[model samples]
Structure formats: C-alpha cells, structure tokens
Target: MDLVITILVLLLVVALSGAVVRILPIRLPLPLLQIATGALLARPFGLHVEFDPGLFFLLFIPPLLFADGWRIPKRELFLLRGPILALAVGLVFFTIVGVGYFVHWLIPTVPLAVAFALAAVLSPTDAVAVTSITGHATIPPRLMHVLSGEALLNDASGLVALQFAVAAELTGHFSLTTAAGDFALTALGGVAAGVFVSAAFGVVRRRLVRWSSEVDPASQVSLLLLMPFAAYLLAEHFGVSGILAAVAAGMTVNFTDVSKGGYVATRVQSVAVWSMVEFTFNGLIFVLLGMQLPGIVGNAKLDLAQAGGGELWYLAAYVAAITLALIVLRFVWVWLSLRFVLMRALHRGEQRPKVGTRLMWTAALAGVRGAITLAGVLSIPLMKAEDVPFPTRDLMIFLATGVILATLLIGAIGLPLSAKKLKLPGEDPRVKEERMARALSAEAALRGIAEEQKRVEETRDEKAIALASRVAARVVGDYQQRLEAAGEEGDVPEKARAEAGTERIMRLAALRAERRELFDLRRSHRINDETLRALIRELDLAEASLTGLHAE
Candidate 1:
C-alpha cells in the first residue's frame, strides 16, 4: 500500500512540476523546479523513498538509454561521427584518469578505485538536460548534434568504466590487459544480445500482427515498452554489458519502424505514450534526488566526523574543485581537437572555416549530467563485503550530485551566452532538404498515377476507365501543386503557390475541427466510440499529409 501510494504521489509530483514550471513568472528548467519540489516534499511533508540500488538501476537506466539511442538523429550522428567519438570515447577515458587522480589527490582517504568510479559517473554528458536549459537558444546545429551523439554513446561507455572500477575495488587488483580483453568481449556480447532479442521480437511481432490482420495498438506499445528491459536482462544474465545491450536495442527501433507506417493509430499512440514515459522517468530521477538531498548532506557530515576528515566547507570545496576541473579538462580537449582538425585540413589544402573559441567554450559548458549520472552514482555498491559499508559511498554520491547541479547551472546560465553572438547560417538547414524530398516524392507519385491510369484504360469498362482517368488527373494535379509549393520545379505562378499554402492551412484547420466534432458527437451520445475513432483516424491521416509540406 505504501509503495503504491509513493508511486502515485511521484507521478502526481511529476505532473504538477510541469504545471508549476509553466505558471512561474521567472523561467526555470523543469528539472531544477522538480528538485526543489522534491526537497519541499521531503523536508516538510516527510516523503521518503526506499531505494534499492539494483532496482533503481534496472527501473530507470535501460529505457532512458534506449530512448536516447532511438531519438538521436542518425543522419547528424553519422556526419558528426568523428567529433562525437572523440568526446564520447576519448574524453571518457581522459576524464576517468584526470578526474580520478584529482579526486584521489583532493581526498587521500578515498581510495583510487572509488575516485575512478565517481569520475566515470561524471564523464557522460546529458544532452537532454542541456536541451531543457538551452531551450531553443540558437546554438549551432552541428554542435547540438555532436552533443546528442556524445550523450548516446557515452552512457554505455561511462557506466562500463564504472563497472570495471567497482570490480577492481572488490578484488583489490587491476590489470589493463585483462580489463581490455574483457571489455571487448562484453561489448561485443552486449551488441549481439541486443540485436538478437530485438530482431527476434520484430520478426515474431510482425508475423503475429499480420496473421491477426489487426492487433491492438495498446498491445503493440506494451511490447515495445518491454523490449529494452528484455535486452538489458538478457545481456546481464550472460555477464555482459547490459547498458550496451539496452542502447543497441534502442537503436534497432529505427529499423523496426519500417513496416509500421501502415498502422497510423499505433504510430500515433506509441509516440505519445513513449514521450510521456521519458518525461516522467526523467522527472522522477531528479525528484528522487531532491527527496534524498537532506539525508545525503547530513549523513555525509556524520561520516566525515567519524573519519576525522574536515568540516562541511571541505565538501563545498571538493565539489567546486571537481566541477572546475571538469570544465577545464573539457575546454582543453575541445580546443586541441579543433586545432588538430584545422591543421590537418590546412595540410590537405582544404579551406574549412576557422573554428571559433566560443564554439569550443560552448562545447565545454554543454557537458550537463542528469538521469544517467544519477543512476550510475546510485548503482555504486552498498557494501564492500558482509556487513561492511562501501567506503565514502555517500560522499562520492554527494560529490557527483554536486557536479550534476553545477553543470546544469552552467548549461542554463552560460551555454546560451556562449552561443548568443555566433553568426553562423543559424537557420535549421533541413527546410531545403525537406523541400527537395517533397518534390522528388511528388514526381514519383505522378509517374505511378500515370502508369495506373494507362493500365486502367486498357483493362477496364468504359465507365471504369473514365473514373480512373478523372481520379488520376485529380491526384496528378495535387502532386504537381505539392511540387510547386515546395518550390523545387520550374517557374510556378506566385498566385498558384499562394493558393497551395492557403489550401493546406485550410484543410488542416478543417481536419482538426472535424476531429473535435467527432469527439463531441461521441460525448453527446450522437455517435459511438468506434465511430468517433474511425472519423478521427481519417482526419489524422489527412492532416499528416499536409503537416510537413510547409516545413512548419
């Protein structure tokens, strides 16, 4: 009963945070607001959650990582692969070493292994949290893409590093060569497991769905929700990287969506459902952090007192120092990386634009940490052995939490300022690409219509042939106008193009009105729920046809 009430309250809090964020006069990031709300809940209202580290990890990490993998723009990911790889893989190792040593040096009592674990948790950037902070603030498109790709890949890499660091601490031994081999084996096995499970599920679902002629959209969404969890569990069962498996499973979702286009209802509902899940899960993470904030501070102080370490001021210094080190380390790496690329370009006689210092700074400051960092810190072992609590576990978690907060503040306050004056093309370049695609699709549609009309003329009765000809002419006219509206074909009249735009707007407006009426009809008992749904679906499809053509 308590568990159920806690969950309900958390969900309510998540929902209320969204509402509260909107009403506040001063704009604040949702995560920050959620954290504050959680603190209020804990201190005054006495909200406390029993957090099992393993359960916390399993419940939160897989789906979030999978969503990152799925949502990462694949085209940008491929284009920015070089820089993304540098940040995600190279920077992770660099942070693990540099930050690990700094952490150990800063506090000698904290073992190197524990420091490394903390550093590893801090390495992965949370682009989603950065997005909330940056909030459509005209950052360069390429930089945003690189940030996103880095977040996607480094979640697996950072967590994997933490896993190894934990193992080293457990056994009191470490070997580079053995760790490398094991890492390779686990990564490969994780990939294989994710691919195998996702592929098998896709094949089975497609066949069953087709055999049934129509499956419930709800059931399809439920299966999709289960997939990442399945992959994570399977990979863990085989003693491999569950993190990688979850990420791979997410990436596979892009390919699996190919045959699903015919199921418009499923597509629409699934997107809505998944978006809500992602938002809720992310909110809960910060809220949970807020809930535990008081205990985390008080407990850390007690532990420090017992160990004769310093006062609470030392904790502040440690967080500040660690956060500064991260920023500096990131700036150095990004600057060197850009310099290397530019030098290489010059040697190759290429004329690439000179990199800006602000871009580098923006990149450095964009390393915000959110849900994955929280998960990694929480996943730290609760005990070293039987009845022995892990050393500095709370302190490390506290430090990590401090970094997460510091980075979020920097991202909220600094990133926009860094990007504000940049005079790059700055427009979303996809408009032109979308136009070109529309024109090409229009040409193909005209050809298909012409071919079908010819076949109908030869193979049908006179009345049927006449109907087919009229239908072809109407559709061909629509496609041709679509091409003209895209402004991709030969000189089209300005008046005709203006008419096309107006026509699309009016059609969409009408469709929306029609959908609302259908819902109202069902509400007023003039129509059944099935009738309402059918009408709404048709309107939705029609609206979809017009939605993206204007690139709006």
Candidate 2:
C-alpha cells in the first residue's frame, strides 16, 4: 500500500513535468526531462524506488510493443521485409559479435560471455525514440516501416540473445542448436498465446456490450490497458517470450470484429484509449531513463576510480569506437541491402524499391536504444556461474548507459539536421490537403444526412426538404472554411490537437448518418442486414484514416 501511494505521487509529478518540458523554450527530448526529474527526486530526497525487473518488463514493455506492432503499416511491412529483417535479426547478431569481442578485449577481466550479454542487451533500438524523433510527413513510408519493424522485432531478437548469453555465462556453455530451438519455440508460443487471449477477450467484450448499453467508456478502455500485461504474463508462465505474445495479441484484436457494439463505438473508443496510452507511456519511459542516472553511476563509481586516467581514457575510446561501429554498421547494411538486394529485386519486378540515401540515414539514426537496454542492464544478476562476483558488471552497466545516452542525445539533435542536410523528399503537400479536405467533406455530408432524416420524419415532404437544405449548406460552409485554412498553412506538420478536434467532428457526422440510414432501411426493407454493414464499413475506413494518422 505504501509503495502504491508512492507510485501514484510519482506519476502525478511526472505528468506535470511533461507540461514543463514543452514550456521551457529550451529544446530537450521529453524523456530526458522525465529522467532528470526522477534523478532529482531520487538523489536529494532519497526516494529509492527500485522497480523489480520482472514487474518492469511485464508492466511497460508489452503494451508499448503491442501498440507499435498494431499501428505499423501492413503494406509497408510487406514492401520492406528484406531490409527490415536484416537489420532486426541479422544486424542484432552482428552487433552482439562486434561489441562483445571489443568489450572482451578492452576489459579482459569480464568474461566473453558477459561481454556478449552486455552487447545483446544494448542491441535493440527503442520504439519511443523512433516515434518521438521522426516526423511521419518528413520520413518516407518505406523507411518508417523498416525502422518500426526493426524496433519491434529486434526487441525479441535482442532479448533472446541476452537470455542465451546469460545462460551460457551461468553454465559455461553455448550451443547454436539450443539457441535456434529456443528462438523457434518462443516465437511460436507467443503467437499462440496472443491469438488465444485476444479472441477470448473479444468474445467477453461483445457479450458485456450486448447485455448493457450503458457500459462505462473508461471500463471498456481499461480492458485493453490490461490486455497486454495479461497476454505477457500468460506467455511467461507458459515459458515463451511475453513481448512477442503481447504484440501478436494486439494485432489479433485489431483484425477481428468480435466486439458487441456498433462499429463507430468500437472505433471511437479504441482511438481515444490508444492515443492517451501511447503518449503517456512513451513519455514515461524516457522520464525513467533520465531518472536512473544516479543509481547507475553510483554502482560504477568504484570502478571508475580504480581505472587510472590511462585506463579511463582507453574505456572512453573503446566506447567511442563501438558507438561509431554500431552507427556505421547500420549505414553499410542499409546501402548494401538497397544496392544488391532491393535494387536488383526492383529491376526484376519483385519489389517496388524505396530508394534514397536519406531514407537509409533515417533507418541508421533511429537505432538509438532506451528502455530495453536499461531493463537488461538492471536485470543482470550480481553473481555469475561460479557464484563468484560478476567481474566488470558495474563497468558494463556504465558503458551501456554511456552508449544509450550518446545515441539518444546525439540522435535527437542530429536527426532533424540530417534530414535537412540530406534534402529528403517529404510528403506531397497537395495530396495531403486533398485527403484532409475529403475527410472533412465526408464527415459534414454524414451529419447533413442525419439532420435531414430527423426533419423528414417530423414534417411533410416540402418542409422537410427546406430544413435539409439549410443543414446541408451549413455543413458544406464549415468544410470550406477548413479547406481554406489548411491551404493557407503551407508545409507545416498538422498539430495532433487540431487533428483530434477535427476527428471528433467527423466521427459525430459519420455516426449520425449511419443511424439515419439504418432507420430508413428498417422502415422500407430496402436492403438486407449485410448490405447495411457494407455501407457502414465504408464510413469505418474514413474513421480508420484518423487511426492511421495517429499512428503516423
């Protein structure tokens, strides 16, 4: 109970600090600010909030990963599968080997297995960093797909590798065959668990909605909030990768229409819940990262002191060397993949290649690691195989922390600059405008139709037509105002707040139209039930465009 109260206070503090992050005029990543706040609270006040590694993994990682997987564009994933797989899987392996070897050389006191473990821990890039840094309008869809896919999948790869490394260190043995078998089983189990959980929940949700029309919106949203953790916990108990399970479950739930309510109700509820969760969770992860500095540095202080200036400089040099290696590895892999694989495939008509040096650079820079690394470092056992001390464990933790900070701080500053320097081709403004305008227009049309039906039921044909004309005119007039306003704002990325407001307006219009159409169809027996669903689905896609926009 005390712990719970402390957490509530921390959450409130973090939430308020989020607003301050924007108001400071000084540009810092919101995560960095949150971390700073956490550190300040910890150091002076002595608030030693030690979160369990298992609890942390179970609580934060699943929903974050699942949400990312659900939102990733399916078409783009199909298109960039080759490069994404290479980076997510192949590059992770390469990083583990490269960094592990270097760490063993630099700190001979640390075993090769321990070094490899450290490398594996640092391998996966953070999804929060990617989402926070990249602009959807500025970055190409292909590149976004590759980056997001790599982040999601490499998380599983990196964790698997870390587990193998840990097991090898503990038992003084490593086998490729065992590793391969474990990976296969974990992946298989996660998918099965996710599918089962999502289906069960969908049925339950449907039944609840059917029985009770006044079900609380918050209660419905809470079910989704719990889903990731539930899926993850179940998978873990069954001896599988919970991360993968949560992601698979989210994807499964998204594709199935097993809910009890109308399509609009489900759609609106989902968008609102996911949107809030994504922002808050993403913001909170960075804050945690920033706050953890004091604890990490304290653990490494003795080692830092023992290592003389000469040794300290060598460590710094090695950190710099490995950091550059990680960065270069990404660029080289991307370039080669494009040149030898993607380009040839395009030529052979196997794929429509998304070609550009700028896109390649975006993929490379987006490789900044965050929560996974922190979680991995914190999870490391204090003792190893012989029950002897884990040599250089603190040093390894410090080194990984350095790599994370460097990548995040540098990438955050460098990304926008790099995008500008490379003269990347952003989205076509005209197409964007047309899409927005049509969306707004469709929304208004739906509202006008609803109002017309209401009047038609109350008045004679002549009076009904007159009232409908006025409503239609008002809807069109509002849409035209928005169109002109959007046209005037040249080349600026639309604010999420404005988009959110617009979405509400459009959704109300769409729902109103569906209700009216359903009423008329019921009275006349003009169409079958399935026909109404098909028509409703057409409007649903327009609503989904809002979901797509939020994902971007």
Best by TM-score: 1
Candidate 1 residues lying further than 4 Å off, grouped into runs, are 257-261, 488-500, 519-524, 540-552
- Name the weakest run of 10 consecutive residues (lDDT summed) in model 2: 488-497
The TM-score of candidate 1 is: 0.94
Q: Per-residue alpha-carbon lDDT of model 2 for 144-263, expressed as tens digits?
A: 567888887888788778878888888888888988898899989988998888888888777887789555667677887788888898998999978788878877777655344455
Per-residue error (Å), model 1, residue 44: 0.9
lDDT of 2: 0.73
Clashes of each: 0, 4
- Give the per-residue lDDT digits (tens) of candidate 1, residues 1-552: 988999899999999999989898976878888888888889999989978888999999999988888788888888889999999999999999999999998888889999999999999999888887877688777788899999999999999999999989988999999999999999999988888878977887788778999767888888888988999999999999999999998887768752366777677777778899899999999999899888888877876666566878988898999999999999999987888888888999999667778878888999998889988998888898999888888888889889988888878899888878776783466666777797799999988998888888888689989999888888888888877777743457455578787887889888888888888888899999888878777887788768845533
lDDT of each: 0.87, 0.73
Clashes of 2: 4
